[model samples]
Target: NAGVTQTPKFRILKIGQSMTLQCAQDMNHNYMYWYRQDPGMGLKLIYYSVGAGITDKGEVPNGYNVSRSTTEDFPLRLELAAPSQTSVYFCASSSGLSNEQFFGPGTRLTVL
Candidate 1:
C-alpha cells in the first residue's frame, strides 16, 4: 500500500496561476497536515485536518486552503499563486495526535 502520495512532483506556475497539490495516503491516518519548506528554512505548517470534515488553518494559511472529506485524502489549494508561495510542499499523516508523521515525497512549485 502507498503510505503517502503526491502528484506532479514538479510544477512551474505563472504569477497568477492556481493549482491544487494532491495528497493521499492508504494508511487510514486520523491526522493530516500540509507544510511548506523554503530554502534552508524549517517546514512551516499551512493547514491541517484531524478527520473528515474537520479542518484548521496553521501558521501560514494565506493564499492556501485545504479540505478533508475522507480519512485518506487531504488536498492543498493555492488560489492565485505568487512568487512568495514558491516552495516545496509536503503532506504528512499520523495515526494519532502524538504519533510520528509520515510525509509524502513533496511537490516542488515555482511561481514566476
Candidate 2:
C-alpha cells in the first residue's frame, strides 16, 4: 500500500515568506499530524486532525496552521516564517490515538 508522500524533499524559504507543505496518504487512516524536527532535537507536534472539519493544535503550533477537509489530505501552512521554523517537517498518520503512526521520509525546510 502507498503510505505517505511529501513534496519538494528540500526547500529554502526567506524569512517572513510563506509556504505550504503538502501531505497525503492512501492508508484510509483517521488520524493525521504535522511535526517539525530540528537538528539534535526530537519531533515537536505542530497540528493534528482527527477527521474532516476537526483539528487541534499540538505542542509547538506557533507559526503554523493546518486544515483537514478530506480523509486523504492534510496540509500545513507556514506564515511569516522565521529562522527558528527551519527544520525537517514530517507528516504522519495512525488508525487511532493508540495506534502506531506511519511517517513519510520528510521535508527539509530552511528559513534564512
Candidate 3:
C-alpha cells in the first residue's frame, strides 16, 4: 500500500482512557503527517515526520504524540483522552515538504 491507511475507522473512548491510532504508507515518502478534522471542518496539523527518527509536533500536538522509527509508519498516541480530543483523524504523506500529500480515508474518534 503506497498510500496511507488508518485502522479501526471509528472509535469510542472514555474520558480518561488512551488509544493509539495507526498510520502507515509504502510510498517511500519522507514526510508523514497527522491531522484532525472537526465535524464538517477543515484539517488541523497534529504532528509530522520528515524521515525516520525525525519527528516534530504540529499545531495541535497537545493531546497527541508521534514517533518515526521507520519510514513506513507514523503512529499517533493519545494518552488520557478527553472529550476535546474527539474528532476525525487523518494521516498523510508526501515525498517532501514542498510536495502535495496523499491522504488516508480517516479515523473518527469520539470521547464520552
Candidate 4:
C-alpha cells in the first residue's frame, strides 16, 4: 500500500495567489500532520488531525487550513499565499501506536 503521497512535487506561485496541497495515505493511520521546512530551518508543524472530523492547528497555521474527512486524506489549503509561506511542505501519517510518523516526499513551493 502507498504509505503517503503529496501532489505537485514543485510549484511556483505569485504572491497573494491561493493553492491547495493534496495529501493521501493508504495506511489507515489515526493521525495525520502537515509540516513545512524553510531554508536552514527545522520542520515546523502546520496542522494536524487525530481522526476523521477532528482537526487542530499546529505551530504555524496562519496562512493555511486543513480538513480531515477521512483517514486516508488530509488536504491543506493556502488561502492567500505569501512569500513567507514559501517552503517545502511535507505530509505525514502515524498509526499512533509507536508514535512514529511516515512522511511523504514533500512539495516545494516558491512564492515570488
Candidate 5:
C-alpha cells in the first residue's frame, strides 16, 4: 500500500552540490522524522516535525533542512553537500497514538 515512499532510491552528488530527498506517507500520520545512517552506525535523527508548519532540529541536523507542509509530505534538503553527508537517509512517520513508526525504503545519497 506504499505506506511511505522515498524518491531516487540512490543518488550520487558531487561535492558542493545540493539536492532534496522527497518523502510521503499515505497513512495520515501526525509525526514525521528524517534520519541518516552512516556506515556501521546507528540511525541519527536529522530533523523532526510534529505537524505541518512545525519543525525542530535533531541530533544531527547540521547539514540538513526539513519542512512539513502537509501531513503527507516531509522533504529533506541538503545544501552544498559534503563528503560527510554521504549516507542513507530515511523518512519515518508515526500516528502519535502509539510507539510505532512506519519507515520508507530510504534514499542512499553519496556525496563524491
Candidate 6:
C-alpha cells in the first residue's frame, strides 16, 4: 500500500477473547503509532515505535501490546479483551514526528 493500512475494519469479541489488529505501511516511515478513540473523545496513544525493534508505551497502553519487527508492519495485540477495550483503533505512520502522519481506515472493535 502507498500509506498506512489496517485489517479487520470491524470486529466483535466476547469478554476475555483476544485478537490482533494488523497495521502496515509501504512508505518506509520511521515512526509508527497505535491510537484508540473512545466515544466523544480524542485519540489516545496506545503504543509507538521509532523504528524496527524499538517501541515505547504511550498514554494508554494497558491490556495492549505491540511489536515492530519490520519497517512496514506494526501489529497491536489485545489480550484478554474486556468491555473497557471497546473503541476504534487507528494506525499511523510518518517519516518523522515533524512530518504528517498517514492513518489507516481504523478497526472498530466491540467487546461484550
Q: Worst ten-residue run, lDDT, model 2?
A: 1-10
Residue pairs with colliding backbones in model 4 are: none
lDDT of each: 0.95, 0.93, 0.93, 0.95, 0.93, 0.97
| TM-score (all chains, Cα) for each model | 0.98, 0.97, 0.96, 0.97, 0.96, 0.98
Q: Count the backbone clashes (under 3 Å) in each candidate.
A: 0, 0, 0, 0, 0, 0
lDDT of 4: 0.95
Q: Taking the tens digit of each residue's C-alpha lDDT, what string does model 5 give over 16-40?
A: 9999999999998889999899999
Q: Any runs in candidate 3 off by more than 4 Å, and if so which?
A: none
lDDT tens digits by residue: candidate 3, 68-87: 99999999999899999999
Candidate number achieving the greatest lDDT relative to the actual structure = 6
- Candidate 2 C-alpha RMSD relative to the actual structure: 0.7
lDDT of 6 by residue, 1-33 (tens): 568899999999999999999999999999999
Model 3: how far is 46 from its true place, Å? Answer: 0.5
Query: Which sections of candidate 6 miss by over 4 Å?
Result: none
lDDT per residue as tens, model 2, 1-112? 8899888799999999999999999998899999999999999999999988899999999999999999999999999989999999999999999999999889999999
Clashes of 5: 0
Query: Runs in model 2 with CA error above 4 Å?
Result: none
lDDT of 5 at 63: 83
Q: What is the alpha-carbon lDDT for the whole of candidate 5?
A: 0.93
- For candidate 4, write residues 20-68 as lDDT tens digits: 9999999989999999999999999999999999999999999899999
lDDT of 6 at 112: 91
> Cα miss at 8, model 5 (Å)?
1.0
Q: Report the Cα lDDT for residue 8, model 5.
A: 86
Task: Give the least accurate 10-residue stretch of model 3, judged by summed lDDT.
Answer: 1-10
